[model samples]
Target: MKSTVETLSPTRVRLAIEVPFVELEPSLKKAYREIAQQVQIPGFRRGRVPAAVIDQRVGRAAVINEAVQEAIPAQILAAVREHDVKMLGRPELETFPELEDGQPLKFTAEIDVRPEIALPDLSTLEISVDELQIADSEIDEQVKGLQERFATLKTVERPAQDGDYVQIDLAATVDGEEVPGGSATNISHEVGSKQLLPGLDEVLVSMSAGDANTFTSQLVGGDFAGRDADVSVSVRTVKEKQLPALDDEFAQLASEFDTLEELRNDLRERVTRVKKVEQLYAARDKALAELVRIADVPAPEGVVREEVDHRKQAMADQLERIGASLDEYLAAEEKTEEQIDTELAEAATEGVKIQLLLDTLADAEDVQVSDDEFGHEIMHRAQRAGVQPQQYYDQLVRAGNAGAVFGDVRRGKALALVMDRIKITDAAGNELNMDDLRGGSAEHDHDHDH
Candidate 1:
């Protein structure tokens, strides 16, 4: 057996292979055995049929076809490995082998390959991240958020106001007829929250209990989606949230802290930690951006086009599930289809560039994803998806995406590697030490949920 490669492009190759007829003898024998077990014969049992009998009954063409089917993939893999090509997707058979008795079999396979990339020097790259500073207002906001969580709702005998909760019955009619599935009773809604329907907040506020009003708005979903409907709301109850005073008693009830001062201090520290985490994320992102900006990585058109198509299909699927069309989506987003397409193309190009860069870096740095890392990533994804780890793992395996997961983990580590070598400065012009932020680990300890 022999193989040679033809460079069709930087990201594609064609392989020509020649295998001696004797090399396929084993595959031919196995094919014969398989056919024998499938065909019924007069004097021979299923497993006892001879190769000659199979050839005579099934014909030489059937045997050759089966053998080639079993042999081509293995032969292509061997050729790819021998040529050290980082193949992508499946190989396309450009030429099929013709089997002649005692003659060598020949064929050609065309495949997409990962393009070679030259990585930039990591030390030369510098990025700036936002300084970690917790403002007093931010801390106050956090405290207020905690207070809201512990607040109690009290029924009020006054008109509904912004930030108040209201219980109301809602009904909708189109063209003087009540729309199907367009009414609900005693639905709780926040007065200023427009989440239920357009222009609902304005009508709900300034209305006291037992007061009703109708407003015309476009229904965005359900059976009457995209149609104008008269929405009527009758307030059953109005309630205002009563927050406890920020005193020691309230602090003790809300948290483990014994005093309000202590609780405020803890909240400040928590906000500070969150800011630091943001800076870490910014650093990682900026590091990758700088690396790609400096590296001469070429994007493979096939991969980029495939990614773009997948993204489009995913968006279409999501919109379909929500009973929305592309025009509805564009209108909601306040953008045109042409703008979205341009943005998707740009994003896809950048995505491919970063992937190629990271993969090259992973190879150069000899980055390896340990079994522990892979399992941890799967568990993290499962937790996010609200599923069991084994279930998620099985799904990935069945979808043949397990390798993609491993590749993502490896690329994350590779980016983390570049993060370690690059220099980062805060807005204050102070050199930031990421080691303290990373718990003294140069590499990120968390798994990437790709």
Candidate 2:
């Protein structure tokens, strides 16, 4: 076999491949044998049919077509490897010739290839990160949240208010007919939560126990979705929370801390640590954005368009699942169709650029994902998805996406390598170290999914 590559563009190539007739003899013979066993001959047994009789029945062209179909994939892979082509997706067969008894077989395949990326010097990149500052008010808010979790609900003989829990009976009718699945009794709802209906909270706030009110609002779900309906609610009871006093006894009951002061100090420290982690994330994002800007690498138009189409289709599917159309979603978000298209296109282009850049970096740095790293990623994803690690791994294998998991880990490591080399400064002009935040691991790394 012999192959030559034609440079169609920086990100695409055409391969002209030629295989000697002798090289195809094995496939041709196998095809003939397989076809002979399938076709019937009057005087011969199934497996004993001769090639001449099979050829006379089925014609030589049928045998050649079978052989070519069996041979093209292997030959294309060989051509790719020989020419050192870093192909992106599957190859498109442009030309395939019918076999001549004494002539060589030739074909041409066109494919997208990775572009040559010239990376900027990592040491020269600089980015500013937000200074870590945990205000006293934020700590106070955290303590309040903790308090709310431990607070007990107390029954109060008063009108329902925001943040108060209430029990109510709800019924709705559309055009003087009851709506299916639109009535319930003793439903518990938080006043002013705005989770049930658009005008529910406003009506509930002034109603006391045994007080009933009927309001007209557009139903957002169920059989009456997008239709105006009269909803009636009767408050059965109203309850308010009674928080325990912030004292040593309360501290002991709420947490392991024995003193209230100790709990506040611990909460402050925890808040500070979380803020510092956020700062680290900000720094990583800025560094990556800078790398994308400076690399200026071109993205293949075909790949970008593919990503865009996938995203658009995904959005359409989600909308359909919610019983809404694309036009309705756009109207709700206050966006025009053209604006959505522009946003998707820009996001897709940047996504492709990021992938291409990180892949090049991974090659340059010789980044490798170890077994432990890959397992850690799988476990993390499984935990998020609420599945067992073995189950998730099996799913990936069945879908033939295990290789994609490895690539994600590799790209993450590559980005982490670049982050380590770049300099990060805080608003206070203090030089922060990536090792201090990530403990010399790629756990802080980020990658584009596409």
Candidate 3:
């Protein structure tokens, strides 16, 4: 088999291929054997049918068609690999010819491909992020948080107030029908936290124990989502928190530190470490945005259209499962379906551009992901997902998604290479050493959740 490519656009191509008649011999034999087993003959058994007899029975055209069907897909993949074509979606079979006795088979496939990108010089770029600073007030706040954790809750007879803990029963009904999973009994909530139903804090502020109040709200989850309902709350008990004094004794009781000053100093160090990590990520985001703005990569329309349709259909499916209408969901968000679709299309285009750019950059940099690095990533991810590392790895392999994980790790390393070439500084104009932040390892340790 031989293949040639014709450039249709920057992100699309047409591949023309020719296969020698001899190459189809194997597929032709297999097709004949399968056909023989399927067709009934007068004097021959299923597996014993001869090729000539079957051809005379089933026609030569049927054998040729079956052979071509088996041969084309494999040859298409081979041609793509030979030419190093970064094809996106499935190739469209544009044209093929009717086969003859000993003729070369010719076919054409048009595909959406990844475009070659002209990246700006990373060495000439610089990004500025906020300076890493941990203030005394911040340390004090952390200490206060510790104190609250050790605080005692005292039951009180007074009405619930802001910052007071309240035990209450809550339920919601839509048109007098109780919503599934929309009721809770004897649940504890903090007043003014707004962590419960909306408008619940206002009603709870003046409601003493055993008092009940009802407010209207729209259910945002479950089958009754997006429906207006009457939510009722009945307060059972109210309690106030009494925090311990900030002293050495309190520090000894709350933590390993024996004194408040030692605890505050520890908190300061913790805050500083957290701030540096935050700065590292902020610089990465700013640098990536700057590179994207300068590169202006163009994504193929076919890939973008497919992604947009998939997302739109997924949303429609979720709403359908919940018994909600598209119009109702859109109305709740104050957006029309057309507007939502346009937004999805735009997002998909941007997403495709970023992915193409990173993949191309990874190739250009010759980045490689080591098993150690890949395993570390899997371990951390498994921890976050509350699963064992080996289980997660097995699941990914079973689902044929190991390639996606490898791609993520490779793309992250590519970005780290960019981070090294580009200059990064704090808002105070102090140049940050990427070496220090990376801690003498490959700088790809940066988050790749993007």
**Candidate models: Cα lDDT each:** 0.85, 0.86, 0.86
* Candidate whose lDDT is highest: 3
Provide TM-scores for the models: 0.83, 0.84, 0.79
> After superposition, which runs of candidate 3 have C-alpha atoms over 4 Å from their true positions?
20-22, 36-63, 81-84, 95-104, 171-182, 215-217, 221-232, 302-355, 375-400, 439-450
In candidate 2, where is summed lDDT lowest over 10 consecutive residues? Answer: 439-448
- Global CA lDDT computed for model 3: 0.86
- State which candidate has the highest TM-score: 2
Badly placed stretches (over 4 Å) of model 1 are: 20-22, 29-63, 94-106, 247-249, 305-331, 334-348, 369-371, 378-402, 439-450
Q: Superposing every Cα of model 1 onto the true structure, what RMSD results?
A: 3.9
> Comparing 1 and 3 by lDDT, which wins?
3
> Please, what are the lDDT tens digits per residue for candidate 1 over residues 254-276?
99999999999998877676667
Better of 1 and 2 by TM-score: 2
Indicate whether candidate 1 or candidate 3 has the larger TM-score. Answer: 1
- For candidate 1, which ten residues in a row score worst on lDDT? 441-450
User: lDDT of candidate 1 vs native?
Assistant: 0.85
On residues 286-389, what C-alpha lDDT tens digit does candidate 2 reach at each position?
88778888877777877887889989999998899888887678867999999999999998988788889999999999899999999999998888779999
Error of 3 at 46 (Å): 5.5
Q: After TM-score superposition, what is the CA distance of residue 124 in candidate 3 from its true location, in Å?
A: 2.2
Against the correct fold, how does model 2 do in TM-score?
0.84
